[model samples]
Each structure stands twice: as structure tokens, then as C-alpha cells.
Target: MTAALPRADVAPVAPAKRRRHALGWLAVVPLLVFTAIAFGLPALAVLDGAFTAKDPATGATSYTTGNLTTSLQGPYLTALLGSVKLSAVSAALGALLGLPLAQAVVGSRSRALREAVLTASGVLANFGGVPLAFAFVATLGNAGVLTVRLGLKDSGWDLYSFWGLVLVYLYFLIPLMVLTITPALEGLRSQWREAALNNGATGAQYWRHVALHVLAPSLLGGLVLLFGSAFAAYATAAAMVGSAVPLVTLQIADALSGNVLVGQENVALALSLDMVLVAGLVMAVYLPLQRRSARWLDA
Candidate 1:
């Protein structure tokens, strides 16, 4: 039997709309190209290096999982765990401190003050790495001005220690959290507060039951962002504590430099693979929470 005739009455998408859609997709080409070059190629390189090794005597290359296995087995494991702990602590503290600061900024009567705080936060969030490390060391290091004035050295406060590195991480992390959570704070409607008050809900109750509930997703997303930021950090921690801090980033650098053992560059790439996985997992959690928060905010 002959196939059924085509539906001649079917409507086609408008040519204008079709052109607009094509343009939209075309507009994304640059971003896709940038991602391919910036992230994709680098990722492929890391994966390739991570699962392969070169024979020193014969100079022959072969694929193997030994790099990953070795990465997870020894001091490498300690560095990974240390980075996780530092990221967790710093992210938690940043969220805790930054949330209230953002709230205060959002609730302030002074517009100038709000803008100033936000601008400062924007600046400070990007203010990290070697300069940040140097600043912290000068201000909080053993012979730092504050250290000398406060006698922190006598108090056993060391700026090159794990906790001191965490404290340095906070310098950027808190500002980052403030910037991240500010928009979420502003999205909390004033009408909700008024209605809660009209119903005899105290200020604390309104925040506890109403505002906090709405802001939870955003807060968690911001926390995750803070976590990823701290986790992937390299320069600041490297500059601040060097080998004193048992961090994955530093370990990667060490492996690349063959500081501990010769011909372990593949192990460095494996460590990088581990870091990418951790960061990917954090972003996986963050993206969903970010979307959820945006939906609530739009509501």
C-alpha cells in the first residue's frame, strides 16, 4: 500500500522565529569554542596523562592505572584529605559569617552603605593568591604587626599552619559568599515580613520560619560555591604555607617538580584528575541548588 499522504495543512514555524532561533544558537558558538579550548582540551590532556606512564630506560610510553593507584595510596591521600578538611571548614565559616553580613546589607537603610559593602565584597572576592598570601603573612605572620602588637607569637599562633591557611582562605571566601548570597537575600520579599508581623509573628519567628525556608537553597548553593573555590585554590595556599600545608594542589606541584620522586608527572595529573572530580561533584550539587533558588526568587 502507498504511504499516507503528507498533511499539507500543517503549519511551519515562522521564518522570523526560525531565523531568531538560528541566531540564538549561532550566538553560543563562541562560548562553545572557548569551552572546548579552555576546559575540554585541558581535561583531555589530564585524563590522558593520568592513565599513562613512560618507561625511563626505554623511553616507551604505556597506558596503565598505576598513577591513579599510587595517587590514592600514600602521602597523596593525606594531601587530598587535608584539602577536603580545609575546604569544608573555610566554606562553613564563610557561609556562617557571610550570610548575616549579606542580610544586614540587604536590610540596611543606607543605600550608599549597601553599595559600598557590595563593591568591597566584589573586589575582595577576587583579591586572592600571592598578594593575599603576602598581606596575610605581613599582618598575621610571626613578626606581623598585629602579631607583634597582640603578642600572637607568644600565644602560639602561627600563620603558616593549617588553621592559619584556613584563616587566609577565609579572607577571600567570606567576601565570595557575601557576593553569592546577596541577591538571594534581596529576593526575600518585604510583603512576607509584613504579613508575618500582621499575624503576630515576631521578627525572629519570621526569619526562622519564613525567610530561612525560602533562602535555604540559595544558602546551600553559595556554600557549595565557597567549598569549590577553596578546594580548587592553588596559588594562595602554595604561597601561604608551601609544603607546610598538606594540600592536594601543593602535592600536584611537588609531583610535577619530582620533589619526592623522579618521573611522577603522571601522578601529578592523577591528582589533578581527583581535584577535577571533586570540583565536578561540588558543581553538580551547586547547579541544581542554584536553579532551585532562582525559581524561588522569581516566585
Candidate 2:
């Protein structure tokens, strides 16, 4: 070599680089181990159990698709359709309501009001299941505040109906959409609006041309999130309607219990079928959304 490298510099550099890599890998170790033990094992177990049938006599296991077919019959099919309709409506309503709320909050001049609105939205976003159900009961249920104050003894306000469920779902979905969409709203350059105004663009024209384009991704993404949330919901339905509503989640829960007439094998198969359907729905919606988002990014 023309000149020898300094030992102190080279030695320290190599060790330091190695140490950094080791630390980086170390940070991921806990997550990797936790995923393998907790999530991976449980999922595999469910899959294996779903496909195998246990003999009620000798406890022998064998493969069968009888339970899977039974799950596809009328009752489960009806529940699936109902769940889809309810969730779709909820997500749509959430986006419609949320977009304006987010706009208002983002457009505010006062910092205190903005912070207060954001804080309230965040609280409501996490406020679903039992607490939300109770809140609704207090507001709109029998002997509720509205009921008593309006003297609507026979107001025909039944919270056990399908529309009632949609209303409850929206209570949670709106806040979530606001939380998700607000970031994208914030990321939008203010100059775009100012530029449009400078060019003699009216309010409607500016919103149509500039604001809508920027917000489309966040809006659709928010709808997808709301759909998944309402689709997979169990607690709200259980607390509110119980078995009377006949939602998929409630049906799945019923099948899993010991009281079901179809037995555990059938229950397992039904659960697997339900899971596959839900997973398929999510992928069907999510793949197109991802592609759209990517297109927007490219543009």
C-alpha cells in the first residue's frame, strides 16, 4: 500500500458500525418473537382446527367440509348481507359528516378552538362499544332525555332496528374519519386555495378543482377504515340488540359457544368461513384503494 491507515480510526470505525447494526437488529427482536409466539401460533391453530373434525365417540380427527357448507345456508347469508349494508351506509355517512367537520376544524383561525375540536374528536374516536351504547341509550332510548323532554311516549324510536344500529356505528365512525382525514387536510398547501382565488375561481370551482383532488385519498381511505370497523363490530351489537339484531358478529359468537345446536365442529367451520368472507371483503376493497392512492401519489 502507498500509505498505511491509522489503527485507532479504522479499529473504532469497524467496531462502531458493527455495534450500531447489532443494536438495530436488537430493537426488532422483541417484536419478531412476540409475533411468532402470539399471533402466528394462534392463527395456525385456528386454521388446523377449522379443517379437522373431532369424532364425538373416540376423539379421532378427520377432514370434512360439512360445517363450512352449512354456514353458507340462509341464516348466515342473510346476516352477512345485513352486516355489509349497515357497514357500507355507516362509512359513507361518516365520510360525509367527517369531511365538513375536519374542514371546519382545519380552517379555524383560533388555536384554542382547533385544539378543543381535535381533542373532542380524538375522545369520541375511541369511544365506542359499551360506553357509546350507553350514551346513545341515554340520548335516544326509551325514557331517554329526548324521549322525556319531547314527551314522545310513543315516539316509535326503537334503537334495536337496523337504522338504529347505523346511527350508533356513525357515532364512532365520524370521529375516526375526522382523525384519519385531518392529516391529509393539513398537508394540503394553502397556496393552492389562494392561487385558485387569484385566478378568479369561485368557491365551488376551487373546491371541485383543488380541494377535492387533495382530499380524495384521505376520504376514501377513511371510508375503508370505517367499513372494516363497523363490519367487525361485536360489542356494540351485543350491548344494544343482543341476539335480536342477528348480525354476523353476534351469529359467530353464538356458534362458538356451547349452546349452539350445530356443535363445535360446525361452529369452527362457520367461524372459518365467516373469517374468510370478511378477509375477502377487506382485500377486495383495500386493493383498489391502495392502487388509487398510489395513482394519486404518482400524479
**Could you tell me every candidate's TM-score relative to the true structure?**
0.94, 0.85
Error of 1 at 233 (Å): 1.1
Q: In candidate 1, how many Å is residue 77 off? A: 0.6
lDDT of 2 at 73: 70
Can you write out model 1's per-residue Cα lDDT over 35-68, one digit (the tens) per residue?
9999999999999999999999999999999999
TM-score for candidate 2, residues paired by index: 0.85
lDDT winner = 1
Query: What alpha-carbon RMSD in Å does predicted model 2 have with respect to the real structure?
Result: 3.4
Per-residue lDDT for 1-299 in model 2, tens only? 57976776567887899999999999999999999999788777766666677788897888777566666677776777778888889999999999999989999999999899888888988788888888888887777898779875576778778888889988888988888888777777767889999999998999998878867766777788888888888898889888767677777777777546646645555665676668677768776875676565445
Q: Mark the regions of model 1 whose C-alpha exceeds 4 Å error after superposition.
A: 1-13
Model 2 segments more than 4 A misplaced: 1-19, 151-155, 265-269, 280-299
Worst 10 residues of 1 by lDDT: 6-15
The lDDT for every candidate, in the order shown, is 0.93, 0.79
